[model samples]
Target: MAPRIGVVTFPGTLDDQDAVRAIRLGGGEPVQLWHASADLKGVDAVILPGGFSYGDYLRAGAIAALSPVMTSVRAAAGKGLPVLGICNGFQVLCEARLLPGTLMRNEQQRFKCSVQELVVESIDTVWTCDFAPRQAIRIPAKHGEGNYVADAATLAAIEANNQVVFRYLHNPNGSEHDIAGVTNETGNVVGLMPHPEHAVEGLTGGSTDGLGFLSSVRRFLSVQV
Candidate 1:
């Protein structure tokens, strides 16, 4: 059977459908997971898409991180389950302590949205194995908080372990080290500011480069089984 990928939808989530479409287009079954449900329904992987969950109340992704589904997500993630958190989802990952570093407001202190370029820096991660090292791809980035920061020690550790996955070519968000994405030590979880799901098809008005991210999950799942 094809891999069953779960796409979690919080109350304010806007990109869940796009994530589902990307999964189907990449040869996987899309499973709709909800915020209130703790059950993952046995999905092979999960995706936390971009959006202002819980109205971005009390900080972006702060409320959604405590949702029931995230409890299960955290547990599953500890077991090395593949999870990709995009944009606000990246904020949630940090808030949940799933991934290191915190996303703060953009350097300009304003919401930014545009098609952006990223250079893949780590190909060993579960969410990035499909891309070659230093390969560049264009994706959409829309967020008020996407700059990544961590303590000096933590940042050094992350760099030492090659946990940084993608870096913005032009540093649109002022992320540390030009970081656009990162992976956990196990490489099973990844978080990025770019909305790969939104860039799956040119008909939607941007490069179809994001399809590789979804396809990469399929390859990762196949290897796991």
Candidate 2:
């Protein structure tokens, strides 16, 4: 059987369907996982797609982090199950304390939307193993609060562990150190403030750089088969 990948959907999630489509396009089975359920449904991997979970009422992803599903996500991550969080999902990861640091409002105090250039700094994770180090890819990013920030010591430790998976080429959001994406110490969990799922189809515009991310997951799952 093909690897079953889960795409979680919270009440305010906007990209779960797109994420599921991307997973199928990448040749993996997409399983729809609900926020209220703690079951992973035997998925081999999980993806938290971007959107204003809980209306971004308190803060982006703040309430979503406390969802019942997160308990399973946290446990699965601890066991080294592959997990990918995008944009608001990335915010939830930080808020859930699964990954390090936090995402704050853009320094310009405005939402930004555009195709972004990112240099792949590390390919050791399940989400980026298809790309070579230093390879550059363009993906669309749209968000109001996407600025990544961490204290100096945490930043240093992240760099030292080579956990910085992707860095923006031009620093669009004023993210500290131009950090666009990062992975956990074990490299199984990754979070990025971009919408790779939106870039997978040519009809959407731009190159298919986002395919590598989904393809990387396919490759990782293939290895298990």
Candidate 3:
């Protein structure tokens, strides 16, 4: 059987179904996971799709980071399960301490929407293994609080560790150092502001660059088995 990848849907998630479709298109079984459920359903990998989780009530992903499913996610990540967190999902990963740095409101204080160009900086992570280092790709980005921030020391550490995975070629938001995505220290978890899942299908009107991300996960699982 193909690898089963779980997509966690918190209340108010707008991209759960789309994420599932992306997963299926990438040749993996899409397992729907609920925020309230503590179980991971034995999936090989997990994805946290973008949306206004918990209505973005207290910050974008702050409330949702505490969901029951996140506990399992944290545990799974510790055990080296690949986790891809996109957009608002990226915010939750930082909030949950699964990844470093914080995503703040756009420096211009306006929500930005655009088809962005990104350079894949590292293909070492599970979510990006299918990509070649320094490959340029286009993906849609829609968010208000997508400006990534961290203290100078933390920022330096991330760079020193080569944790930055994707970088913006034409930066749409004022993310620090043009950081579009980053991997955790262990390289198993990755979070990015752009919506790669939205670009997986050509019918959606863009290059199918997002397939590399999902395909990377499948490749990772295949290697493990």
Candidate 4:
């Protein structure tokens, strides 16, 4: 059977459908998990797609961090269920403390929407194992608060542990160390500023590199058994 990966839907979320489509194309079953729902419905993995969750008030993902769905996501992730957060979803993971660091407003103080070049830095995580380390790929970056920041010690730790996932080739958002993505210590949870779902298909004038992200999860699931 295909892996069941849940796509979370919070109020104001814009890319849930895109995420669902991406998963299906990657040969995984997409399950819609509501923000208010208290359980994960036995999904093998969960993805937090990009959007202005909770309308971006009280910080990008502050309110959504406290959502009931995240409560289950937090628990599931702890038990090694893979979780991938993109853009606003990345913000939520930081707010939920699932990954280290905080997302701040872009250094340029403007919303950036573009196809971005990124180098996959580490393939140790469940969401990135299909990628070769340092492989360059194009993905979509669209957000005003995509800058990632962390304390000195925390930065040193995640770096030392080789958790940094992607780095922007041109450093679009001024993220610290040009970091575009990262993973948890256990390699199960990953968060990135770029929107991989938006780059799943070439017909949409998008890069297909992002398909690897979704397919990697499917590949990860296949290896588990």
By summed lDDT, which 10 consecutive residues of candidate 2 come out lowest?
Answer: 199-208
Q: Against the true structure, candidate 3 has what lDDT?
A: 0.93
Q: Count the backbone clashes (under 3 Å) in each candidate.
A: 0, 0, 0, 0
RMSD of each: 0.9, 1.0, 0.8, 0.8
Q: Tens digits of per-residue lDDT for model 3 on 12-130?
A: 89999989999988899999999999999999999999999998898889999999999999998999999999998999999999999999989899999999999999988999989
lDDT of 2 by residue, 1-225 (tens): 567999999989999998998888877889999999999998999999999999998888999999999999999999989999999999999999889999999989999999999999999999999999899999999999999999999999999999999999998889999999999999999999989998888877477888898889878877873
lDDT of 4: 0.93
Candidate 3 residue runs with Cα over 4 Å from true position: none
| Model 4 bad stretches (over 4 Å) | none
- Worst window of 10 by summed lDDT in candidate 4: 198-207
Candidate 2 global CA lDDT score? 0.92
lDDT of each: 0.91, 0.92, 0.93, 0.93
Candidate 1 residue lDDT tens string, 1-225: 789999999989999998998998888999999999999999999999989999998988999999999999999999988999999889999899999999998999999999889999999988888988899999999988999999999889999999999999898878899999888899999999999988878888469889888778888888674
lDDT of 2 at 23: 84
Candidate 4 displacement at residue 99 in angstroms: 0.4
How displaced is residue 47 in candidate 1, in Å? Answer: 0.3
- How do the residues 76-152 of candidate 4 rate in per-residue lDDT, one tens digit apiece? 89999999999999999999999999999999999999999999999998998899888999998899999999999
Off by over 4 Å in 1: none
